[model samples]
Target: MTGLAAASLAVSIAVAGAGVPAQAAETRRAPATATAQVFAVDWVSLGIAVAGYLFSGGGGGGGLQAAIAEIKAAIEQSKTEIIAQIDAIAAAEVEACLEAHTIEFLNIDFMDEYTLRAWAQNATSCATQASAFAGAVQSPQAVDKIGFVIGPIFAIVLAARAQAGFINGTDLVLQSQIRAYEAVVTKLTPTDCQLIVTSEGSAFYEKWWRCTAYNGDVGRSSPCFGRNCLPNRAMAETQATLNTSRPVANGALPRLRAALP
Candidate 1:
């Protein structure tokens, strides 16, 4: 028994001994003192009860150990459950990011401006969700083992966004080049030239030849040709985006797989 328990037991025994003698003296003093004797007996009983409690586990013995062990086990189980749930959530997010954005971004080189723009919007939405998830996991306090899993996923989303920006930029450039070409062609074409109805349609062929020659010259000097071509630049941008995001996606895959069941 602990020192406190031993001390309590000794005090209870002393109280019991003193109470018995007092009860005997009180009974001898007066018949009316029977109540007093009973009160003394009650005190003795109370002391015995307190002593019994102390001797058992009230003083922090085996019962306390058992209770503490049970509490610890419950806490550990709760922690494990919480961690598993977080791991599952992280795995799902990583997979979604990969499927909706990362894989599609890899095919950017093959997508047209319209297709690329559509994909960009989708990637942007995915990135928004990824950013929110990343913030939730890190804020208030960072969760253990989550940063490793989420960091690469977030990076790949950002890369997708960057690739999306390139798509928009290239589209603008292509549009501008088209407008410039149309303006030049409108200025060069003879506005008042009338086709003459002739034998074997010679006047019609002559007009067609002149227009074709002018258009060919414009085409050779247009932004659509050579290294300044928007299509080539767009392709280069797409490849660059793929290069930047590939490592992040590759690195995240292993971590995401590990986090899953």
Candidate 2:
């Protein structure tokens, strides 16, 4: 018999044994002898056997349904747990990216007071010129107000754009994790699921460590060793090579936006 058929038969027999009602008559029967064959068969024994078969069939069906329900519940729980972990990871990744970008900005002299003031003045001059050009087509006072707003707004936009780049990088890493997690879920095997989760965790740690190492290389190679020095220069060249090697995906922005709260 097939495995499923055998399992069904076993369940039926077990249920029959458990639910059998007591009977007064000797229900056990043997193959009839030529003399005994002439006598009539017992109708009561036939009824009992039919009843047992029906009861066993019903119990087996119930058992199969219970098994199915259990499997479904397990899958649902696993999905929920995996998604929760992904969300937490995504949040942490965003925070890390912001922190990294902040540090990168701090390292750049343009983020310092003197350089910042110079940039602000340059941005203000550009805004004033653009406004004057637009004034020919709109209200002069309105254009002047717009220019006034643009000075500070432009600085804010620059800072925001810098932050966005880091956030975008974080989104790429999160997308990788999501894809890996989905692959595990699709396989729906215990071992594959465990491996995927473990691999994702390892990847996260490795990326963070690599970023930290890059920062350290930047620090060691700065000022005393001078610009375009060994390690920092090499690191920049290596990153540029990696960027070229990877395929660019334009749709990543929308994916990252959806992940946001």
Candidate 3:
């Protein structure tokens, strides 16, 4: 059977049927037979196959049927324990991967300083880091981080677009938008900066103008001078960057979770 088919069968047996019913008489036999078939066809193909049959269920007459049932029960318990261990290991692997990237995704050091130049420089660095992370998630080596069993299982179960695809695409858009912002920041006249700084108090200006300027939300009237006063191209670029950056950053973790088993 194919790896996916085998995983489907194994997952059903291990996850849903792992707890054999107390009243089960012939039920153990069915699952045991399914387990054997998983291995018999190509157990190692999925790298999740158990080593071998632990019980033969064979012997002479005289209470042999009762003895075989006991052995099957024991075997099922062992298989359940093994599957639990694998589940724990796989979960840890995925958690480690998520923890490693969480800080980077949430980093907004660009906004740390009030200066426009600081925003531009930090944004560039953030974009570069984001792009690199995007590649990391999509790389073939991702299997190493997500674990062998989880990677394929999630691929089958979670049909969401790969995490890297979404982030990388966002990075590309951000890169273009950042270049435009850089152009505007460099070209701002001293008069323009003076007018922006004096039009409002520092705290309010930081809160309002920064939102409009960084996010490129040209739809809202500029707090300092209204929509008609600010540089048009500059506002567009900031809006473009904010429009792309905010959603991607916000959704990164949720998307990662949804993509995993």
Candidate 4:
């Protein structure tokens, strides 16, 4: 039993035995006079009956002793139950933080799928348990112990990690675009304009004459006569991609070059 509970019970037992003879109290190793106090234990009357029995030499402190012991046991049991309930609540909050935010943040890159999944699961467990003690304090004081929320410290951590991952993905897309442009640039050599500009229908253009190269072809022609075409093949191809909303094929570069001026 807690010290407070034990002290309270002792006071009650003493009160019930107040009427016992001073000699009897002394024989029992109790104080000579009972304090003018009433114990809160409702069963104190039963203890008083036991005190009467004590005076009669039948039973003295046995019944009240039993009652005090029972009270102490009940108090201890109540304490245990309350603590268990709080622990359950704390565990629930930690799980919420893991599921609601931590896992999602780690899922940004599929390349990191296995590694991130493993790391996130482990980190969540560690962070959650670490936050458990915070539950004992007010929520504001123990920010991490609370459930997942966009504005909380946990959410901030998630955002920071996600941004870092996003930067990597951005770099990859940029590098691919740079490589595609470089490939087209390497293939485009300087072409001399033909002696005559003739209108020829190209395969990729409806009015092929408008898009036909400067050098030599006349109406809806497919083959190029020489290295005679637009100045910027790569930029035109990239723009075509922007217009069509997809990657421009390498084979289409020759046709796209014809359209570029």
Candidate 5:
């Protein structure tokens, strides 16, 4: 998503989902499955952005000195957790490929982040077992302080476009990718995490986290979507979730938005 979109989303719902503004209700409706997933990913990136926002010594209430330790710990802990499943998938794919081929490798090496399984007789070339793994595994993008901070906003904007039908979600492969991301973000974050916006109004989108009043009055908005849906964050979030799918994981669409165009 573009920075402009992210700016719009962040501005909209910097608060909580269930407590989002009422303005969104007038114009924007809930988005489709594909669009909602984009919001999910944007939140992850936003978590990092929230930390960055804290860094400039701004945003949130507690002083930076007081929260710095906790914030860093959260980021560090989250970082370890974020990469585990991806690595597991890559490892399993490599093992399965070797087993199926009945190939015995003497040694494995990396080139441009791709795996090269070498044997005495023949060598295997890897852009990694899958290109999905290549970008993620090869010199995995270090969590840049700036990019990590700004990325969420960028993603949210792109997602807003998708939610608004500016981006197409007809591709089945892309939908699967969305599902997997949904799974990962949910799994890595607190189990009590709540999604303000959802497609089908299933339990999946129910409020689990405490709702705080953002641009709108705290207790006024609906559990699914507030009265206004606040244009920037909540609006975008609600719009993104309007018509989302139940995340299904087949690894078809593993590439993140940055990894894409």
Candidate 6:
């Protein structure tokens, strides 16, 4: 009977100790569950932050690309507009110069028919003088005999007409060069235009002075001043102006091309 009682008492103590341990385990598990939930929330927050950062970076990059494209387009448009303006100016200048030169050439007076006939007759006289001198073998100088008989009349009419033609042609070509320079200046900025005008004007005046000086010599008589002198002079002047203006024109072409789109 005592053994039975003792066993019952021990069983009660064991039951009480098991209840305390079970309560302690419940308390630990509750804290562990709360800690796990907090960790999950922290992970979710970190993922959200990273996603937001990526979205923002992409948005910024796209905006930057769009802005750059707009700027480039604007620059291209500006270049095209500028180039067109310049070309129009060039065309007008060319036309004006051409008209001036054409008028000058057309208005030139030629030697009259009577004068031409008289000059022809002088050539015949020269032939006769040459034949007579050749036959004499005492050889009267052909030049001296011809000059004594016919050179003066030919010189007065033919030479005067020739000289007039030369001066007229030179003026025509110079006018053309002026027109070309004007056209180039038209494309430039007002400031650039002023520079071009000054440069071209200087070149024109220099060539004009030289041409006048050259033509002043009695020996330099021809429609183009004994050669292609006037045309050559005008060409030189045009080239000089081009040398100054071409870089600016060429630099603008790429921008103009880009702007077309």
Q: Which candidate is the best by lDDT?
A: 1
Worst lDDT run of 10 residues, candidate 3, spans 46-55
Off by over 4 Å in 6: 1-184, 187-235, 242-247, 250-261
The local distance difference test score of each candidate is: 0.31, 0.25, 0.27, 0.29, 0.28, 0.25
Write the candidate numbers in order of decreasing TM-score: 1, 5, 3, 4, 2, 6
Evaluated at residue 156, the lDDT of candidate 1 is 34
Error of 1 at 191 (Å): 81
Summarize candidate 4's per-residue lDDT along 42-132 as a digit string, tens digits.
2222222222222233322444344334433322323332222223334565544444443344343453656654554444344434334
Query: Candidates 4 and 5: which is better by TM-score?
Result: 5
Per-residue lDDT of candidate 6, residues 66-106 (tens digit)? 32233223223233322232233223433233223222222
lDDT of 5 by residue, 147-233 (tens): 111222222222222222222322322233343344422322222223455444443443212322221212212354443343233
Q: What is the C-alpha local distance difference test score of candidate 6?
A: 0.25
Instruction: Give the runs in model 3 whose Cα sits over 4 Å from its true position.
Output: 1-195, 199-207, 211-246, 254-261
User: After superposition, which runs of candidate 5 have C-alpha atoms over 4 Å from their true positions?
Assistant: 1-75, 91-261
Q: Lowest-lDDT window of 10 residues in candidate 2? A: 189-198
User: What are the C-alpha RMSDs, in order, of all predicted structures?
Assistant: 40.3, 34.7, 25.5, 38.4, 18.0, 48.5
Looking at model 1, which ten-residue stretch has the lowest summed lDDT?
A: 206-215
Summarize candidate 2's per-residue lDDT along 172-246 as a digit string, tens digits: 333332332222222211111100111233233111101111112211111212222223332222222121101
- Top-TM-score structure, candidate number: 1
How displaced is residue 242 in candidate 3, in Å?
A: 5.1
Q: Which ten residues in a row have the lowest lDDT in candidate 4?
A: 31-40
Candidate 5 weakest ten by summed lDDT: 140-149
Q: How well does candidate 1 score on lDDT at residue 186?
A: 28
Error of 5 at 63 (Å): 17
lDDT of 2 at 30: 12
